[model samples]
Target: MAALQTRALSKSYGSRLAVDRLDLEVERAELFGFLGPNGAGKTTTIRMALGLIAPTNGSVEILGLDVRRHRSEVLPRVGALVESPALYGYLSGRDNLRVIGSQLGRVSEKRIDEVLEIVGLKGRDRDRVRTYSMGMKQRLGLGIALLNNPELLILDEPANGLDPAGIVEMRDLLRNLAAEGKTVFISSHVLSEVQQICTRVAIINHGRLVRLAPVAELLQDGGEFEVKVDQPDELVAALKRQQWGGEARSEDGLVITAAPDGRGRSLIKFLVDNGFTPDAVSARHRDLEEIFLTLTEDPVK
Candidate 1:
């Protein structure tokens, strides 16, 4: 069964449509990424999925339970950290978890210790939240979410304010969670982080889904081999004659729709066999930032 599913989910405020017939299916133990520009209704969709707000025309199902109808049953199995996490500065990290845990049910100290250790707060868990960094606070919030041993976790920009090292840690943490059979859904503007962490991604533009695919497949299609030559037009014509193995087009060089592997060597040999001697050749896989810009700029295909 899918860990989460949304069927023609939609929301509208007055005359403005926030989410337009969004449909998605996320499987169990998958690290799913949700991406979009600001005002693309990512938050609105999340809120509706969490049953914080009612959808105007559709439904959300988590763990095979309809969110609207099984609020009491569904919520306990799901954990979420939306926007910035809320923490009490006056209280210690341990106290914060205790307070949140107290509301849920009777939580043992061993469980508290385990959560604190899992989120990397064991050493400083007794410290006041005000003294903790943004990364620490985020982890603390995550610890609270894990208190119930949730099966599904929904995070909005979980790595928003972390440093490079913190980002890496968060990535590893998500991967470990998924390995442990926990489903993780993250929505973030940090394309690189999403690229590294998520197995599959869904991009929404103008409150509608524009693209959805595996991270590897999308990167493979987006990357190109830069074929530099002394004569651009002539070399391009020659490549056309050679029947380039992959889709080839001429711009700054031959933007072949393939990563430069052994094919790069073949391309160089092909160029050398022809009249043109290359100036420089380089291989570059289109990173998430470029792919994201291209997708967001152009109309959804």
Candidate 2:
């Protein structure tokens, strides 16, 4: 069963729709990224999935159990830290964990230590939360959420206040969680970090899902198809005549783009069939930031 699944999930406030027919799913042990710009309905969708808010038009399920019907049973297996984590400024990090763990029943002192170590806060476990750095508090919030040893972790902007080193630590921690068979679902606008940490990503823009693909596939950005043909000008004219958008450089030959749909090879075959000998063909890959911009900048269907 998918760790989490949303079918036609949607939310609206009066005339404004926050989410629109969102169909998404995450597999077990997958470090999944939910990406979107600010105000793109990421948090709204997460709230609906976690049963913190009701969807206007659809359903959400966790491990095949309906979130609405099995809230008690499903939520226990899920842990979440949304936006900025709330911490008790006065309480020691260790004591804070004890306070939260107390609600779930007799949380052993040993369990608190284990979580502190997991979050790399063991050295400062006794320090007041307010005295800790932004990175440390973020880790502590994550530790609090881990008190239950949840199977599915849903975090929104987990790296919000983290510095470079902290971000790296968060990334490694998430990878380690997934390694331990925990499904990690996160929402963020951080494209590069998402690319580095997540295996698969779903991009939503203006409350609509524009793309969903593996990190490697998304980064490939349709593969830059560059070739040096014997007749550069003729090649340019032929490509234009065929309605293929490509540019011809004076000294460098022709530069074209190929999506995963095999358009590049078709172009090559068309050139060969027309008796135009080509010197060579090569492909270049794009990074995640570039791809993210292209998706969000275009019109969504």
Score candidate 1 by lDDT: 0.85
Q: Tens-digit lDDT track for model 1 on 93-207?
A: 9999899889778888899999998888999999999999888999888888888889999999898777888788889989999999999999999998899999999998778
Per-residue lDDT of candidate 2, residues 137-236 (tens digit): 8889899888889999999888987888878888998999999999999998788889899999999987889899999888766655666777777766
Candidate 1 stretches with Cα past 4 Å from truth are 222-224, 228-233, 237-284, 298-301
Model 1 weakest lDDT span, ten residues long: 253-262
Candidate 2 residue runs with Cα over 4 Å from true position: 221-223, 226-256, 259-281, 298-301
User: Which structure among the candidates has the greatest TM-score?
Assistant: 1
Please give the lDDT score at residue 73 for candidate 1.
92
TM-score of each: 0.85, 0.85
Screening candidate 1 with a backbone cut-off below 3 angstroms (N, C-alpha, C), the clashing residue pairs are: none
lDDT of 1 at 195: 94
- How does model 1 score by TM-score? 0.85
